[model samples]
Target: MLPLSYAIRNLLRSKSRLAQTVGGSALVVLLVMAAVAINQGMSRVLSASGSPNNVILLGTGSEESVQRSEVSENTTGIASASIPGIQEILGVRAVSGEIHFMNYISSDDGSRAQALIRGVSPAILHVHPEVRLTQGRFPAAGEVMVGRLAWRNLGLKQDRLKIGTSITLNDQTLRVVGRFAAPGTVMESEIWAAIGDIRVVAQRETISCVVIRLEDPEDFSEVDLFAKQRLDLELSALRESDYYGRLSEFFSPLRAMIWITVSLIALGAVFGGIHTLYAAFASRVREMGTLQAIGFGRTTLLLSLLQESTLACLTGTLLASTLAMLLLDGLTVPFSIGTFSIEINSTVALIGILSGLLLGIIGVIPPAIRCLKPALPTALRS
Candidate 1:
């Protein structure tokens, strides 16, 4: 058996090859970690955005997208009275009629970007308990409240969305009165204003949806029955969680594209690493033959080679993990619906480490076997 020092020394024999192996592995592992982070971040935000105890009443044909749904403004009042199992705080029922509008908003500096805007009343707080004001207070008649992460979606800086600042929406200027946060949810990337203000700006007589919070999740059937009985309202009842879950499914193709892109890139890097390892081992054939003639088994030589390759790949894994933590962790990324923060938690890190180990093992076998295949006498002649 070769000493551990033998594998270590062989790795340093060619600094260029060592660097190539390490760099290749690092790039592949980093890509995998990034893909995992993106998919996890998007999924986490969507799932957390909805509450099981809540139901969304959308216009019958627009159940898939709240922004596209339009219900009569009077439905909010009617549902509040008709829904029997609804939660109540004091005399007020936990129901909110909201308007969701997505359009270009302009900063004070004249830069415009698309943002998800929500129009709500104070009753929204009762329905969505997760939202809390982090700075200033909720919006008044002509003012707006920005989410702590809304700046990212607007392509602006933090200072741009600060309280007292102003933004242009639908050619109407509105003051920024506060910042709110709904942690781990897409709501953190939205802009909120008074329902009347948005209704005027969006030029719609109807609201997007009416969200109601039930005392118990099991009471959903009662609400569903109401929607079914009221044929004139043209309403559809859906659990809030199920709504967001369907959104996740709707984005399946985008996630699949991400995985496909990462897989293709990683495959190329793996082949390149294998070729480099094979060439490096091919040049060391005579040395392996000499060791074989000295009573060292071919299996031992193969194991030593694997040890060297694994060491380099594992080092790259460490490098990739560090880079991902520094660059990707907690980074906010915006999409059509909202923004999510990439978090390289323990699970993502573990997957990255395992990917590195696989690269080490899979990348070495073919090259290692071929180099150690020749008989001791024939190999020495070469």
Candidate 2:
């Protein structure tokens, strides 16, 4: 068998071809990683929107979004009373009536950006424990707690998020009193305030949604049935996980568009890979023949060619992954599903590696087998 060093030497001998193959594959991997990153980031943000133990009550037929839902104020009282299997801390049941609002916010310079405002009670802090105040106190009535990402993206500092610094909302100015962080969640992109304050500002008479903490996840069916049967409340219950999964439906088409585009680009790259590897093998036909004549088996020639192709693809994968981590880490891309920042995680790394190896194997096999088919005398002619 030909030693591994022989494959290395063969690849090194044709540096330009190797670079072309590697660089092409790298561009392909880069595109694939970027698409997958968007999908992964979206999944992370939407999944993180809900807690594992919580159940949500949305307006009947409000399947896509909480914003579209209308849960009546009176329903909150009935839900708390009638809903069984709710977990409690001390003596209080875990339920919160929340209002969701969106408003335009700006820097002191007047550069405007959109922010989602979640109105909640003190219990909200307990509901979403991931939220941490990095500066100032929790928002008081008439004040807001901006997320860290929101602050950074909007170019506001803690002091800039001043006690009296006001942001216009529905023609009313609301004070910014604090800043918080809820890492890796959609909450990171929002501003939070007292429910009463937002209701007054938005002129809203109804709460947006009701969230209840369940004793166990299995309690979903019971709660869901109860909520759906309550014609008086006109509400429906969704397990938090299922709610997010439904929310993921918003991104499904966008994700499909991305995968389709990636597939087309990968198709081109695969063909390019095949062409490059075939050319590389064709040019080295004499070398392969020489090796075979020297008693290197056909299997050795095949493995050597495969190793070469694999090395090129692997190099491209690493390049793409590194570029994604460094350049696109916190870069947000706007999509109809939801705006998501690219996230590069270990899972993405693994996917990229597998993608590269698959491309290599698919591209090199035909050419490698062709190289091994010719008799040594016939191969030497080339």
Candidate 3:
């Protein structure tokens, strides 16, 4: 069999063609890897936000978003009291009543986009411990706190979302008094306000949902059952983790759509890659014949060709993975997916690399088979 160096030299012999094939293949691989990574990252962010020790109370049929649920203040209080095994800290149960809304905002240029607005209380800080007041203080009644992703992505600076900055929400001006950060969850894309104040401003007499922390994670089912048994409250409870899991299910169709679309595109790229390999091999018919003319057998020629394709593909894979890491690492994109945050972790890189190599192997098979089929004389004539 020819040394691997021989295959390397052969690729270098046609530098332009090698560059084109590798570059094109790498671009395709990079896009696919990025989409997959984003999907995985979003799933991770959603999963991480859920805690088995916490239970979420929402109106029935409101599985994904608390905003869709409307539970009266009295109902929230009763449900909070009814849930067994709830932990009380500093005389207050580890529960937070919240409200949610979205509004369109304009930058200096008047470019507008939707921004998430959540109404939270002091308990928000406890319920979502991952949240931190990075550059400002916690919001008080009638004061709003913007998240880091919102600030970063929308260019809503501390001054823009800080104390005394007025933002129009539902035609009512509200003050921005604080800015917070929740590293990877959907919460990072939101601006928070005092729940009671938001309710007053939005004319909402009821809260969206209530989040409760339990004394023990194992008590979640019991608390859920307790809430369920109290039908007068018209409330249901789920572990915070399970709540987010169900929310993640809401985005599964979108994820599936991306996967299906990418799979079809990958199929086309694979065919293109096969065609390129076939052409590359066809050009080297005489070289294969020369090897066959010598002691080298058809199997050696086939193996060598496969090795070349594999090497090319592996190189493309490495290139794609490296680019994704460098470019998409820690990118905070707003997805409709649960807690939409894209994280390009090591797993994503590995999958990207493996996908490239697999595509390469599949692409080279037909071309490699052609070499084994043609006799030495026929290859020489071609």
Candidate lDDT values, in order: 0.93, 0.78, 0.76
Error of 2 at 225 (Å): 4.6
Evaluate model 1: give its TM-score: 0.97
When summed lDDT is taken over every stretch of 10 residues in candidate 2, the lowest stretch is 151-160
Using all chains and alpha carbons, the TM-scores for the candidates as numbered come to: 0.97, 0.87, 0.92
Q: Relative to the unseen true structure, what is the C-alpha lDDT of residue 148 in candidate 2, on a scale of 0 to 100?
A: 65
Worst 10 residues of 1 by lDDT: 373-382
Error of 2 at 226 (Å): 3.9
| lDDT (C-alpha) at residue 324 in model 1 | 100
**Candidate 2 lDDT, 89-192, residue by residue in tens:** 77888888898887677645465666678888877765566789888878778778777666544445544555557776766666877877777777776778
lDDT of 3 at 174: 66
Please rank every candidate by TM-score, starting with the best: 1, 3, 2
Deviation in angstroms for 44 in model 1? Answer: 0.5
Q: What lDDT, from 0 to 1, does candidate 3 have? A: 0.76
Evaluated at residue 165, the lDDT of candidate 3 is 67
Residue 245, candidate 3: C-alpha displacement in angstroms = 1.0
Give the per-residue Cα lDDT of candidate 1 at 213: 98
Better of 1 and 2 by lDDT: 1
Per-model clash counts, in order, read 0, 0, 2
Off by over 4 Å in 3: 105-111, 152-159, 162-164, 337-340
Q: Residue 138 of model 1: what lDDT?
A: 87
